[model samples]
Target chain A: MSSSEMTSPEETPLLEVRELSISFGGLQALNQVSFAVEEGEIFGLIGPNGAGKTTLFNCVSGLIQATSGVIHYEGQPLDGLPIHARSLVGIARTFQNLNLFHGLTVLENLMVPVEVRQRRGFIADAFRATRSRFGESQAREEAGAILHLLHLGDLRDVMAGELPVGLQRRVELGRAVAQRPRLLLLDEPASGLDGRETAELGALLPRIARQLSVTIVLVDHDMALVMRVCDRICALDFGQVIAMGTPAEVRNDPTVMSAYLGASGAVQVAQR
Target chain B: MRFDRQLLVRAAMVIGAFDVLYLLADHVGANYRRLMTLSAVDGLLVLSLVVLTGFVGQISFVQAELNGFGGLLAGAMIGRLHWSFWVALPLAVVASVAVGIVVGVPALRLRGLILGVVTIALALAFDAWVFSLDTFKAQFIDRPSLLGWDLSDDRATFAFCLAVLAGCAWMVANLQRSKTGRMLASIRDAEVAARTSGVDVTRAKLLAFGISAGLAGLAGVLLDLTIGTADKQSFTLLISLNIAAVVILMGPNRVASAFAGGIFLRWGSEILDKVGVGGKYLNVVLGVGLIVQLIAAPEGVVGQFSHIRAAAGRSLRRRVAAT
Candidate 1:
């Protein structure tokens, strides 16, 4: 896994979001939000409620099409690709609420993406035919590698729903990574976790980015996680880019402070 | 490829058990033998529901519609087109896939009870229009004596139907363990989540629907071959509802439960008829049994057995460890 893509940021950014905007009915959910994520970087999107952070993730992942503007992945336009097509093209995402299959074990959950990555037709797979069985051993090897990578080796055969929420979140992350995505979109992965779990997640993001050689764009409300892990952070407010820079620079910006802690209670944010 | 040893063993067991039962059936009458054949046909129908509602979680009340279409088409090919039954078999399955796709298209947009209601409507339309067509009906239905075996005899018909049902059952069992099986299971658990995981939800659901319908079609073709008729009236919405009830009673994931429900109900009805109760009144038995199953064991008889088997395996492992 190479981190060399981070050094050549001058080349076409791994993901370039240009003036993306969308509206649900009359309310403009996102308005001209723009940012570029270089490869092997843990980029964070932080904002208060209704700030269009999730909307932006949805647009980039192709869950919903943007009303205007464009998203370029590895210098290629992702305009016409469907949701699963985007995943096939090395884009993967997790939901705000965890979406792991309750019936399947953690190993099988990871195998879903491994099977998807193999791109074998279901008809052949139904009969256990040539092309389907060809990658069976390799897929298991890859799934084992991922289970180890995600620290889920212990819970390999445990049903995904039986695991703790923190572990389920980890399994969901492992599942997305199993797709071999170049750009991983994580939506509010820390919503239900306690301090310890969130800290562990904060620790995992950078390791995932560096080790897997994937660019990360996470939408989160946890400021400590945002400030601690992200190489650079983008702040959104009322569907627009409010701040875009290093964590220190963005933290010091007055507009971001007022947007989060309000103008009067600004200094209290440092304690939070 | 290595065959699943357990499945092969189970298939042999089912066949051996039925042969033993055939000895007792001979003392009773030819009616018992005929019911044995019906049991296998019913198993195919129940397996159809297993795929549609069980794996895909798509509620389809139009399974009988698809089944009737396949049966009649196969019959027509054998009778009207003067084609061999073996040749018409694949054509029937292909035609059922087309019908399944049509029924499944609405499923891409609809769900649950609404989908069921839509299928019910489609079922009536099919009986009144599609199945009523001269093209789908054949007056000259004949037994498929493909390998020079007379399939018309009671024992032979039961054996042949049982073999066909077992073959389909084996194929379906293999499917549920493969990647496509996981794909369908994932869709059942979480459709949106599956899409984000790079599973084309539409394709997975439709594929399930197609395979399920094909099974139903295959069963229907076998039914026409056995009984020498493919009357559309026999495939009413009532039969589909009965199948749905059995699907709920037997548990979805357990493939054997489909056959179990079929054989139990077929014999149950036969016994009921001999004991001065109308066999049609078994719907009362089904309803009561369903109520009991829902309250005591929602996973149904098969799921209950699965739990017991797992527990027994664990205890056996512990015993070996102690030694």
Candidate 2:
């Protein structure tokens, strides 16, 4: 067998977006964008502001419907599923701005997603059945484990809003991890972090991908961290893919250099 | 285990307070008993607000209308169909929940003040059209006699109303600590976050509405029992506004706070009536209280009490250190 076949014999891309387009009134937010993310790969989506990176993530997570085209996950069409259904089917995400539940504690924030996976109904909960308690304890244990893994064990009881931005981001990441998702979408995870915190996150992402065997799709403006961590990268300009390849190949591409600098400066950067 | 201990302490305090009130009513006279019974029913109604406005952060102005629907159904079932109180109560609650879902599903598209507007319109419609129907007239109710005891007896009815209030309070407490409650709270704080976390946002909101409406329906049955009639005036749009005002003034976080709100709403009005001010002035008092609550204690009276307790503890600790 070939080396590619040896790695993944049943090689089916985890996510495939085809000719997706969405317009807000007269302006096109995303214009016929398409890409495929393979299993267990740390795929990076990098672009300047207003390049429609978040808009694409929203479309993939089912937060907003695309005006046209199809999205396939695990080889099945994700046409009519709602946001929660998409999450249940192993697609979990975090927001660019910290969207942690302000009323809940760090532990409680993690438990919210875990509790949703429990089978106990509201009647069972209201009645305080043994099954409900068992489900609750299980969720708590899962949340605790994720907290420990993320080094947030000490801040378990801290209100999410009281935490600093770095810690809040960690809590959001821990929450998504607690869901035990097969695919995780993170929007600007390194946006508010200092250099040290960004480095820690850079190391943490690959470790998470390796240990959990989870594919990651990350959108961010941190080029240094993105180049170091992501196995493959896709760069966008004007809601269209300008370059898509391995990190080294994308970095060498003239279009990417021009997109970052300017059309005239691409040659100078490439020469250097 | 810590959670259980806290819950146990809260339960004991609530039951003990109710016991004291019950004994006091027994000695004071029928007038006091009548007031306490109304307060108990109001307690249930405020709890409906606790689930929706407090936990889910959905402002609704139609709780009284939902309460009226329950009373109307109870009157029809017990009076016309000759059904027992036990049979009519659950049926009324279920029917009210169905109506709540119908209203709640569409209201989900709107948020904050807009949703409040829709609910106000609904309350007006219920008062002007639904409650005025001939079938729901106050004369149609029939008080049930359960297990050799007639609920028509003032003392028996008071005790029965207290019992129902206790059950509802216990259930509300249980729901607050459960996963369902956490999910609802999450939605309240952040809807998009809750949705991305795998919570069915629509379903959670609908369930909150149903539970809120169900509690109001249960209160309606008790209200009808207390008065021995289904008085449309008691469940009017103005009454709904008053109930919402009370919840805002008393805090909606804990079940005990809802009970406290109910007592304050009922007895506060009685005090004004005794002073020759009458029930008409009660709304003016509530409006002033609501303003004070917003400015001084946005978390409401119960939350303010906790803050005071915390401050006192800190001061005591500082004094000990200084000495």
Candidate 3:
């Protein structure tokens, strides 16, 4: 048995990806990439555009099937599971492009995951029975709490699509958090945010990881936010992991520096 | 709960308006009363489209086909099997729902124009083969006798159909506020996002189709009873396209829109007839109306009205504050 397989239940990683690989028609998107996210840690995946960061996130969340790999969540194999099934098993994700439901209100957007996690049946919903009523009320309350946590309580009734892009990203974060998942995958949560908003998010991510006790795998191109927020960082270049270590170690790595800045340039790391 | 008062007022207004219409139909001639009844049945059919197309963002041209299936089944159960209306009604709805699930299973792999084509194919098949079956060719379908009072009376049947429409509207309104409804909207907005959030997109899609089919089935039975005949010609593919046009023209988000679409579907032709306009002219009007609405108000007539109302309210509040 592998060392990872021999880990006890209590010490098992929250998420383990082994030799994951996926290729498009003629181009390889990800190649034999592997990583393990510990519980309650803010892990970061940093790469330039087309480095397959989003693709890796998609594979972990089961939105895209890996060409070859084994993903174990909490020591159980997650092979062949559908996206919703993975979500039900406590895997929640936010899109790189904000995917908030445009037709629904902000509060209703947050309630989507809560509703999915609840136990209301179709018959109950059709009849407007007690179970359905109670479940909806509970979902609303939970969503309200999440909105408050994200400091978006005032915009609860606003249409999601009508919100600013920065606010939309926060709403998407709230939606993923509302799932109450053990593992959360956020794709480019700071992509479109201004510096102030990105800084706020940088502080918020670690606090969320600590307070909620949830593991987070964040993929973002924002170097400063990733360096400040993430405990460990994985830098990928052309679908290959170039560095995986503490944020400082990744920042100092020659390959990561060369990948970010061209080979001729001297590495000068910026301090946040 | 902030909108509770508004909701109550809207509900009261709707009920009062329908009550006034009921009284007006009572005083009017039988032809007018029959028109109103048919309009209510059409309202239910449009509501099915509202749920499927408006809320779930799925375009289906098979609603009329599902309606035909229900009408045929209800006719068989009542005319041949000697079943009561209550028994036959539920059976017909359930059967249509089953067929909806069957169609929805294959439809899961299809979306947008392809799905529309598949539904159109289903509609054509029903029109060509299913309706031509000897068993579905019932001369007359008997109406139910409720509480020893024959519902064959025009006024009573009108009231009954009105009540059914009201009940369906209320249920759909309630559904829009429910969790399932939110999930459906999410699926419509972003299927991948909804799936990542743990929503069973396939199940939600199937449920949307099922509810739509069941509602269509109810509308079919009511239409058959109102006309006092089971004519297959009444549910042609052209009728399906016409209903789609009406729903799109009038909007499908609100039950009021569906109700309005039904009225327009029935009375628009009547008005054209009264004006000595040919039936083909009515098609031109519908086609033009659909194109105009799509370009100017894609949210539909009722949705645009609400937007205007909200804007007006905001301006009024601003003026009051300024004063």
Candidate 4:
């Protein structure tokens, strides 16, 4: 179902998850997770390892189905949709592990999502695709624009696999943005970057959010970057939300502090 | 959609280059000319494999058999039913495409050795099925006249087949530059990522299969046209294996590379004979070559050429900068 057919855009958040829970075999991964992201907000999801942060992102993106609960995008339920289908509903995601199409050129990597979104059909692609017929495809122009936005115009012809990790991360982000998603889910955008690269990414993320007018839900281990840029932050521990509020509130919350530092020893650290 | 001047110039250049080659083809002896014709036809079959195996990362050993369907069906239509060549051509293509899609259904769920086995089974079935049809037995077929010109002459038929191969090459190259081109390339690398990127993985695979099969079918029809018969021996599982080997050996990267591979596979033995080293030892040498190819150049010979060219270009650029 389309967002236009939804009940009301104003009434519903861009993304809403209610009591989301999942498990692999018997191990409880996510339990009663709930949150709502407002339109055009830079939302951060932070948790320690095994806290089901990636699992939660997977559930929302349609790679992993939650055992129970609902995921709504612009008031439309996205729980039953496939991963690719979620992209059509304006939800695009970057992987915690970079999944760029390495065989393709940098420009072609960005063009892939744009082409997939805009392609008519196989027959059209073979005989009448505007690019083949006219020599300059709209996909190229769109991809070129993304390269410019990502400041990757110089490396457009380079193979994606040959690029540096920081540049590759940026290319992956560029690819996700090329989908023109309204609700972008970034799984550790700062994962493999150096301090300088992380700082550059931190600066770029908010610009992407404001310029594209997109609602972003970024999950990362980098606490400083999340704290600096996020409008709101949600902390998860053992698949349960310990705190959800403005970045200051979540960071200062005692439960979040205890969850990260351990309840018994954390108080002692504070005492000292 | 403005008409591009560079595109037109490129098109002219491609055609001009082919015509020059075609003129040289007119001078070769009948045997070599005929062998090259078969090579071009084989190249078409190899081209199909490139799309499936190289681009989509699917294996098929039935490409030659698919070509046989075009050859034998069109052959039977013209030879037994007395239908016109032009009329049977399109019907044969569609029928082979249908067969391709049917074969592709199993491929959707199967991959690697299982997929390879499935294709081998299909190829064997095709051989047996064609052998059972009495009317489909080896029969003389005539090439049709195009635009009031008779194609009964060997050189004329060879020229026509080359033209078709060139067209197919152009189409394949064009498809690569299209949106679907990137989709297949993505499918080749990370299929799951392609799916999440909004690529309908199933449809894309089938499209690759169908298109590849269609090209093979066309090549099969051309094979019959060039040889003057719908020979059952041409579409055997052995032929399919050879075509598969050719694609792998050539490293299915470029249309030019595939065409060159086809020439090598089809006429390599003949060329070897001309050089006075043709016998049982040839197969041994080929086995060694294949082993070397796998280890030394997984991308195929064309891949090596491109690598060398790239290295040369880098050095040249460096020298230019120094100057």
Candidate 5:
């Protein structure tokens, strides 16, 4: 069931998650967390390990099912749709772990989702979908556009695995952008990068969101990158939403501070 | 990133080089020609495996069984129904593609070793079911004809197989550059990443299976045409094992390793038999070669070539600068 307060937002939130919960066996990963990401906004989902950040991502992307909740995208419910369907609806995401095919070239990596987006829907499959000659040309054009945007047009021929860690993340990002998504969910885009790489990511990310008109839901542990890129932040502790506000508000909140450093530890750390 | 004039020229140059090679090979000795034909057939099968295993990252051990479906269908249509080879061949391909979809639906749900086990079972089942039926054996003993021409002759069969192999290669090469190829590659690398990136894992897997199975079916039709009969004994489980081995042996960049593996199989057998040992010894050698290739050249021979070329390019550039 959706929250009654979901109607409060007038701009028609790009992604609306209400009371979403998920669990593996008996261990609950996400617990009744409600939030809405506005269109073209950089939204952050932050938490300690096992705080259900990735789990929530999995739910919205349709990789994992929500045990109880409603997730709406563009006013349509995204509860039972498979992962690819969510992708077709302009919802794209990356992984917490690097998920690039080492064997393929960087260019090949970017072409994948663009091809999917170029595919005609289920009706096309049933009625000689491939017979439509427009599909192939469109796919090629879209794929080329994505690769060019990522500045990976040069590395297109190079094997994806051989690239450095920073480049791989960009490749992953490029792959997502290729899908032409309205909402992009990035799971720890700055996980293994150094300060410079992270800063480069910081500069590149906003341009991507602005140019592509994509709303971002980034799940990260890096406060610096998150604070820099994210317009708003949602803090989770133990599967529950403990704080949600602007970066400054969430940064100074007592619950968020305590959640990061224990109840008494926050004061001690502050004093030091 | 820009598709410049130089890139187009390079692509044309590569295609032109192949044409020259193709012309040169046309005048070679019969034995070499036969090996080439076998290589072509092998390449077709290997190309299928590359799409399924290498590109899609689904380890399928049942490609031989899928080929068997093509060979058997061709035999049944030609011998029993008196159908033309052209008609029978496409019929076989369609049937194989259907089987691929059916099997893929179940197999795709299971990943890693589980998917491997399930597909292997399908391959084993194809072998056992065909060999066990006397009616199938008796009724299906016939030559596969193409365009009303009985294609039992070796020379004609070689030409036909070579043409089909080239066509198959072209299709695969185009796909490798296409968006579908990228999607499968991404899915193979990381399904979660691909899925979140808006790629549908299941559909991509299914398409990969279909492409691979279609190629296998095409190869099977060519095989039956060469042998003049469709015997269940011809497409052994070992063929599946060998194809998988070939993929591993060739590594990733060498999509053409399928052809190389075929040539190796043809030459390696004769060399082994000429040494006074029987043809059975070839499998042992193949097993060893497969193991060595997996260990020594897991990137396959093509990967090694690229590596050497890169190193040579670097050295040459340095020398030129110094001069």
Candidate 6:
């Protein structure tokens, strides 16, 4: 329930991306980068464009086949599993670009995962009429609760695409969380959010991580929000890890400063 | 607001009236009833198109080929092997579903133009290589019969077709409401996103295609029985185009569009016949209709209605809030 309670070394790491590497034809996108996210902690993956932030997320979620590496998810090796199987194993992710079903309503979007889970009990849902009625009700209630949590309960009936970019991102996040996963991978969640929206996201991220008992792996460009929300940060440049430490340490790390602010930015980091 | 009991009653009345009219029309003129039966069979085939291309966003011209597969199998069993139509029907459906699964394995990895090209190739290959063979053609030489039921008449075949169409409609509706349906929808909307959400895109696509083909195959068996014959010309690539036309006209979400599309197919042929035109010109008309529908209503007829209803609901809500 609490962040500190989730940090025991003996307990399983929710996700462990070990020496993960990937390539696209002539270029290496990810190179022997390793990181571990503990339960209920907000872990941030930060880098500039082409630093393989999204690629890392893809590999972890099993969208991209790793060139060579192991992804241990909650003590189980996730390397062999496909993306959806990873989801069934309690891993859910939101895309960098909003991927909400534009034609579907927000509630329906949330219901997608629930319906998928219900499919395992398809015979029961179809034949066991009494139990199915209760199951359907419970699924709807959970979807509603998720919508409510994301402050989009009123928009449940509205088309997801009709919502503004900020709300759409929120809905995307909500759908991912609706799966009730142990780990949540968010790819550049702050991409389009304005300063105020970013600040709101900063405040909301930690609250959601705690509320849902989900370990958050946030990849974002908003350094301020990342610094504020993430318990630890991993900085990457050219597919390799530049720095890995607590937010304050990473913010002050000379290597991280150079990765973001260039060679001269190290002085500024030291000054800060 | 009152649960639209009047709408329900009106719908039931119309359906009942049509059924009675169909029965009477069968007695009055068997040919007219035969045409209605044809339309229902065509409607069932079109339902497959609507489900695969419309709902799941997998473009396969092989739907007609799948239908052909059914016809050929039914023909071979009943005509050459002297098997009953009852035995052939389920066998044909299963065979087509197997073929669909085979095609889907490779086809699922392809998208858009590539997918279209690949499936069209598959359809062409099926026509040229399999159907043209003497061994294959030899199987479809006799009249078909069901369990103690001769399908040589109009009324019996019409009832059978109607039942098939109803089953296809129910199955599609159930699928669309199921998790697999949502997964296919997600893949259609955004594959990458769906993949991240833990959806097996390959499996979803295969299932969609398999179900679509199975429905088409079932419809085809019914068609072969109704016509009392299986001809290569009837199961040509043009049938695929016609199926696509129906899907374009009716859209993806509504099963009723299948029937609407079938009626259009029948009317197009009839109007062409009356106007001294031929089946060749029907293609031209269908092509134009497809282009127009894509431009005017990419979501198809049902989509347009839903859009309008949604807009109306929004306006009504705004007005209520203002009050």
Candidate closest to the true structure, highest DockQ:
2
Measured against the true two-chain complex, the DockQ scores of the candidates, in the order shown, are 0.65, 0.74, 0.73, 0.51, 0.42, 0.45
DockQ winner, 3 or 6: 3
Best by TM-score, which number?
Answer: 3
Error of 6 at A99 (Å): 1.7
- State the local distance difference test value for candidate 2: 0.87
Per-residue lDDT of model 1, residues A183-265, tens digit only: 99999999888998898888888888888898899888777788888888888888988888887877878778878775332
lDDT of 6 by residue, B1-323 (tens): 45478859867986896688566657757767777788888888888877787777788888888998888888887887888777888998999999988988767678888988888888899888888876457344344445766556567678768766876676676556655566677877878777666677777788778888888888778777777677666777767866876787778667778877777776678778888987558878777877887899887876777789999999999999999
Q: Write the per-residue lDDT of candidate 5 for residues B1-323, one digit (tens) a residue.
A: 56578879977886686566566456676667666677777778888888888777788889888887887788777777888777888999988888888879875679889988888888888888854565346234444556766555555667677767766766676566555666677787777777766676778788878878988988887777765677677677888988887677777445677677677766767777788887678778767866887778667777777789999999999999999
User: What CA RMSD would you report for each candidate?
Assistant: 3.6, 3.5, 3.1, 4.4, 4.9, 4.2
Query: Which has the higher DockQ value, candidate number 1 or candidate number 3?
Result: 3
Q: Candidate 2 chain A: minimum summed lDDT over ten consecutive residues — where?
A: A1-10
lDDT of 5 at B196: 69
Question: Residue A134 of model 6: what lDDT?
Answer: 65
TM-score of 2: 0.93
Tens digit of lDDT per residue, candidate 2, span A63-109? 89899988999999997998988888999999998999988899999
Cα miss at A272, model 5 (Å)?
A: 13
Give model 1's TM-score versus the native structure.
0.93
Instruction: State how far residue B207 of model 4 sits from its true place (Å).
Output: 1.0
**What TM-scores do the predictions have?**
0.93, 0.93, 0.94, 0.90, 0.85, 0.89
lDDT of 3 by residue, B1-323 (tens): 86789969988997898789889889998999999999899999999898988888888888888888888889888888888888888999999999887778766888899999988998999999988998788658767777987889888888888889888887887787788788888988988899988998899999989989999989889987898877787788888888887888888777677789888888988899888996558889988888889999998888898999999999999999999
The residue-by-residue lDDT of candidate 4 on B1-323, one tens digit each, is 34588879888998798777677678778887888788888888889988888888899998888898888888988999999999888988988898888888888789999999999988888888855588677778877898887899888888888888888887787677677788899988877678777877888899899989999899989988998998878788887887777777778766676687777876778767878888434556667777898999988877877889999999999999999
lDDT of each: 0.83, 0.87, 0.86, 0.83, 0.76, 0.78
C-alpha positional error of residue B45 in candidate 6 after TM-score superposition, expressed in Å: 0.8
Evaluated at residue A95, the lDDT of candidate 2 is 95
Using lDDT as the measure, the top candidate is 2
Q: For candidate 3, give the docking quality class from DockQ.
A: medium
CAPRI-wise, candidate 5 is acceptable
